[model samples]
Target chain A: MPTLLEIHNLSIEYKTRLGTARAVDNVSITLDENKTLGLAGESGCGKSTLGRSIIRLVPYPGRILEGEILLNLDEDVPYENGVVEKGQINLLQLDGDQMRALRGKKLAYIFQDPMTSLNPMERIGKHFVEIIKAHEPDTPKEDAQVRTKDLLEALDILPERVLDYPHQFSGGMRQRVMIGLGLTLTPQLLIADEPTTSLDVIVEAQILNLISDLKDKFNLTMMLITHNLGVLAETADSIAIMYTGRIMEVAPTEALFESPQHPYTQALLQSVPDVRKPDRKLSWIPGSPPSLTEPIPGCMFRPRCPHAMEICATEPPPLMKSTSGGIVACYLYEGS
Target chain B: MMGKSITISGVFIYLRLVQESFRDRSKLWWIVLGVILGGTIALVASLIILAARSNSGLGIPVVVGTILFGVSMLVVGLFRTLLIRKGTFSPRMGTLFLVGVTCILGVITIPVSIFILPAGWFDLWTVFVMGGVAIGIILLFLYSRYSWLKERGSPGFLTITGFLMVLSIIYMTVISYWIVPYDPAAINVGPILWPPHPGFPLGTTSLGQDLLSRTIAGGGIMLQVAFLSVLICFFVGVPLGLLSSFRGGALDRVLSLIMDAIFAFPGLILAIAIAAMLGPGVINMALAIAVVYIPSYFRVLRSQVLTIKELPYVEAAKALGARDRDTMLRYVLPNSLPSIIVVMSINFADAVLTAAGLTFVGLGLPIDVADWGWDLTFGWHQLITGAWWVITFPGIMIVLLALGFTLVGEGLNEILTPMLKE
Candidate 1:
């Protein structure tokens, strides 16, 4: 499959009273066309920050220091001149207007908390209409409302309830409404950042199923950022395990799950209690992810790695091919 | 212990009445009957007092008609009290208390809104009477239909009264010329310092200009200044705040500092200085008052923007490729509206007052113009001479107008505060 997006040596830093902390290090990721890429990590693993940065919406004090977010979509090339190179567009170089034009249209993003993510004062239909009208001012409000109804219907929500305000909807319905909003524009890439974190298990399943169906329907290249390994297993085609702002492993879901190469990925997979294997004891990785405020030499996960060696401490391990048909950043995978 | 229940709020007393009356061995019908009886007696006493107070006695129908409506409210209150005593009422005593209190408030506003109009202005008097009756009926229907109307989230007495007060002033301002018996500026229209005698309602000023005509006409210019100044402040300050907070950095700091500098001065003193500098014209006075109020709107909107922009919805909007303008207008502005509304009503109250103060100090329209501030200031010495009607009527109009805005502002604040949890 052709590469849909690629990040080259991306670095994001957050300014603080103490000092600027590097939240996302020189991380490189390649997302395949029409494929779901899972970015899994613990909380504050810079996954959400990384997801926000793709849309150039890093929260205050946090910024993209250096990165080339190449959007490889072959479409109308929504760029002026300099940002486009040989068909692909470097999103980082686009001006405010160009970058925003791609948002909600080519690259839409959904947040974690559904309750607070929708504006309380605005009705669900109004939210859709505002976004549609913003991009296409010629679209009549009624026309937009018709499209909103169709989208809501697909999400299993009553289309007639479109005029209802955010507070009127329950948590699950609001999330569905938000999803409908994201899908209304038929975005090329939908970055869902912990989209089901706040929802109950049943709603989460329904949302995941809805997303899977929509992904096929829209032919969308999705970036699913979540800490839930099981969620990634069900949804993502390929998984990229992120630890301390660096990708420790990148492999197909089955390859990573069946023959996980990176110790961190193994530790993560072991921690998930298996219902099928009743005798298998659940495990956990000891030691917290290190503070990003201070620089650390060599592997970011070296201190937490059970197989920590002198070589792991000497220098940061480069991502290399592992026997599991995936890339691993652990030194133990060298020449594997 | 009883005093606690009787504390300043009449609502608490109503609640105490219901709870205490429950302890009485009287039947429900008897209790309701007693309230109707009491209301009749009170109505008779007010009629006697009003009938005796009327000098020409021709205003007896208007007075008698207004009091009869007030008595009908006592029946409405008893209906609500009994409704609350039924299971349909929310178990919260606050809602029950609000129902009883609003009934009392409805009755109270009838007298207060009525007394302000002199007996002779039949057209003006009838409009207020009809308007009050219409509102009371509509409200009674609404309150009876929806028990949720008594919820804490609902608008309270102050907001309702404020709406009436403000609307009446605006209505009076609009139809003043059509309704006024004489031209507001027409001198020698009545005897000087006349005390609301027949043919000369609201008495007459020292210049023999009709005080009722002057008071009614006075509203137009004051409202114009208040509305214009508020418009200017809203246009300038809201944008400044929105831009500063949304586009924070040097702009936020610089704009916030300028607003703070303006806010640092005493409101009246700043208006005085500005009005003094600008000199006396309607536009000039509006500009002067606007200078005093822009900082308030700025501070309010700026802080609101600061808070709202941080919310997830704002970030989500940004993610949707929304332009800065869209994010500000669709997301930020709508979310910030509650405080904006509160500030606007409060600002209007202060603006009109400041305009009057500016005019009082010889800074508004020419002295011969029929403005409340000019008439009040010019007629101040007449009050010392025991001719209270001249200053008193005009003074009461200004107070009522200002009070109208204050009530709306505070009432909106109470209603909207809980809705905006973020």
Candidate 2:
């Protein structure tokens, strides 16, 4: 199957008070058509930054130093032209006006913090109408209002609730409103960055189920970035394990969990306390990830990796395919 | 006993909060307190000065001594904050100084009032000399403490208060005319420039007329200009600003450009130009002042509108298909109030000063008229010939009134702007 999206040798940097910090370095990942790719890492481990960069939404002072996010739509397939064109456009090169056209129409994002994303002063219904109008300016006002009502209903929000302000809605309801917006245009790829982080556990489960049902209904391909291992196991088809600005492991969900090849991956899996088998002691990674400023002398994880050896301290580890059916970046897996 | 002590401690804590709020160092409570205290003292001293005309009374030196004490309090309030900022005085010490200022000013007023009584009702020469010395001492203290207080109170407050104070003093002068027997412009060439005596208090002006009556009548005219100018400026400026911000694009740009051009020139020059064309009167000066102020309000409203317009809810409203006018009026304007108020308070002061400036420079209301600016302009000449009462009294009144308005405006701004409180 052809790759739906390919990010090759990507590196992102930000100019800060404490020198240039390399946020994402040499990260290469691919997702096939109709498949889900989960990018998992600790907070500030460059997971959200990667999701934003893929959609060309990274704010100022940080730029893609080197990389290409090639989003190749299957051109021969006959699909809704709007959804097709949304995923087909080269977002990195478009100017603000052109990029704006892509937002809410073709390519859409469900931001992490929904509170600030919505305007506090205006009615929710009014915001919904604007997104439609911004993309389809010539659409009659009556049609836009009707579609807004339909979208709100689809998200399980009462149509009357649409009249309320963003502040009036609860955390869960706002996230659903955001999801409803992304689904309105039926965009091909939905980039959700921890959409349920602020929500409660029950709300998180409902939101996850909503995403699953909607993705299936719309046949949407998604890139879900989250720090929760459980969410990724349940929703993601394949998982990319990231550490210190690089992908340390990438494998099918079951394969990565059942038989992880990298030491870091093993450490991460061991850290999750198994409720079914309550006797297991949760293991920690022992030390923090190496700083991204300046070049690390050797393997970025050497200081923290229990399996670190003499050679691992001098030469940076390169990712290699393992016989166990996943990629791992460790000197022990070099020959594999 | 233990319970009672705890209750007492809790009560003390509550009282501290209230006092701290009202007497906040950042809010410049001392200056405000000082001004209020000083004004009360000055009013009492003036009355006493007039009332003492009948008795042998305190001499000019004694009145001057009282004036000096009040002046010191004003100086302390103004400079106390500056002294703290510069490390010359710690905050606790500053508070002590403020308390001292209030007490001292209150004390000094007792004697100062005796000299302010009507001439011959007291020793008239002694009252003048005493009042002059007091005012001089106050000015000297304020000058010395100027830099210190500058760090404490806002210039915006000073600006507004100064303008209102001058207007109030002028109004009092006009009202004083009503209290006296003669009109300000009344011709009585016979008893002109007769020096201080029982019936013709404050002696005669260079016009050989009753100075007291003219000073009293000038107050009403000043009231008319101050109130009218502020009203016109607010009425015109606020709406023009709202319209420009809402319409934006070409209209916003044009409104801003026109306003910028008007604001570029000195306000008095603009008023003079308008007066020259419209001919000299309070109405023309007011119209000119209104035109100049429109741009300031427009600028404030425009920035506020821009911030409120971009909020997500704003987009939601647009999405809901709200008309632009409805969105602006119902949403944008209300949220932008604190800023609008801050600007208006400052502008009120500006309008007053601009009107006074125009009048003083001969581009506004004429000098023969009974107005504060007119009184000060002609009265200053009398000050040179040892006829200090002619200008000194009115000038001091203007200064005190301006300071009062400024203090109030400053307090409001400080309390309203959360960012400035700490």
Candidate 3:
């Protein structure tokens, strides 16, 4: 199967008061259709930054130093498959107007805080209408309204509540409303950044289920950015582990869960509380992720890695194909 | 409290009834009710006594109508705590107690005014009215204390009370016009410094004209000048401020520089310059005052606009394809209104004062127009002698009316400032 969305060698930085913050550094990932890729990282590990970079939502001062977002729309065209077409476009090369045109139709985003993402003054129905109107203004207003009402009903919200303002809805309902809005366009790839972080456990499960269901229904290639290992284990088909703006490992979910090669991945797995193994001591990942402002001489996790050696401090590990089904960027896993 | 099931629906129903009752009461109807029962009787009895002394039935209806309107307004106001309320007055015993007390006070004041002021016990009516006003102030103060302690955030009652008092004073000024008939400008070569009489009420000016006529005419001039100047200032200042804030480049710098230069100009001196340029008249004086006020309004609006411009909503609107004009007008302009309203009021009072000062210096209107400043100009000399009412009345009127505007502006500011609202 062809890769649906390819982000190659992406590096992003922003100028902050404390000097240049290397938010995302040299990250690469390819997501295939009907596959779920989880960008798992702790806070400040550039997971959100990487996700935002993919969607081109970086506000200001944050510059994409080097990258190309290559989205494969050719697969949808019957005759263009496996052909090197002329005038192949990259997303970064597109202007703001072009980006906006492509964005809700081909690319969509699920923000973490749905409350702030939405206009508080407008009704939920109005928000959907505006999104549809922006991309497809020629569509009749009455038609858009009906479609949005139907989408709201599909998302388990009452159609009567479509006229209610953002303030009238509960947080979970708002998130669902947001998710419905993001998926209403049926974009090729959906970038969801911590979509369930703000929801309760039950609501989180419902939302995750909803996203997964919609992913299959829409045949969406989803890039789910999250910190929760359990969430990734449940929802994502594949996982890319990140540590301080760099991907430490990428693999199929079950394989990675069974045998996590990267030291950081191993430490993350051990930290998760498991009810099946009640006697096993819950492992703690000692030390914090490396500060992005300072340059890492070799491995960013060298200070925290339990099996760190002298060479690990000075020489950065290159990502190599491991036997178990994926890639690992670790000196210890060179033979795997 | 004893046996009531105070459900949400019950509370809601009670609140609805209270709102309905408040909206149903008309200000005119309340005033009419007050006149038939409260102070009109006293005015009629006084009119009869005055008729016996003068042996002339000269427009008793007009005098009665004026007194009826003014006194009944107060009587209705005293009762408005119950009758003219807007929101829920939930059947609290404390509210009932307040209503009862106001009714008692209104009843007592009626008989007291009948038996007191007209019987050469003027001090009694003064004391009664002052006492009522004092009690209102105290109640307002107590309400403020409660609101502060309760952390309700807004001084809502205090604002309404302040607004009521200013409104009443403005009503008083407007109603006073009904008592006079002769045009204030019609020259009278009657005896100068004539004492109070039926023919020459409020005595005569040094010009041998009715001071009452001049006072009435002067009020009209002051209002016109203030109204016109403020309107012009708003037009010139608000747009310029919005322009500077939204387009912060060379255009902004140029607008700011011009405004600063204008702001640096002395108000009186600038009035004098415009008056000198255009020649002294009400129109010229208003133009000068408006010109001087523009800079102040511009500075205030520009600063407010700049602050609002930084807010995220502006960017969000821009991102949503809201045209620059649409964003500035819809988002930035509406948000900046409170500050603009506040500044305009202060500038209005300042405009009035400036016009008065210019006229007093013989630089505003021509010598014939009965402006408050002109009245003060011509009346101040009479002050050195024992003709104290000449300068005092017009001066007091200017100061008191300006104070009324200030109070109203402050009250409005309390309501308009979203950050300050509860």
Which candidate number has the best lDDT? 1
In terms of lDDT, model 2 sits at 0.66
Model 3: how far residue B305 lies from native, Å: 6.4
CA shift of A313, model 3, Å: 3.4
lDDT for B354 in candidate 1 is 91
In model 1, the Cα lDDT at residue B170 comes to 64
Docking class of 3: incorrect
TM-score of 2: 0.57
- Local accuracy of candidate 1 as per-residue lDDT tens digits, A64-105: 989799887566634433332335888898788778767887
Higher-scoring candidate on DockQ, 1 or 2: 1
Model 1 per-residue lDDT tens digits across residues B211-280: 7678767888998999999999889888888889889999999988999999999989988898889888
Report the C-alpha lDDT of model 2 over B1-422, residue by residue, as the tens digit.
11111111110111111123423345455577557655745663453344334232343334455345546655676688689989999777997987766555554554554545544423433333344344544454446533332333343234333433443343234224214445567667437556767766666666766665564455455455656766776677767777787777798888889888987987667766876787777777767776666677777777878777776444433433344665677567766665666676666566666666676777767556766566677767766777766675556555554555555457456534535644
Interface RMSD of each: 8.6, 11.8, 8.1
List of chain A TM-scores, every candidate: 0.96, 0.92, 0.94
DockQ of 2: 0.08
Quote the positional error of residue A86 for candidate 3 in Å: 13
DockQ of each: 0.34, 0.08, 0.11
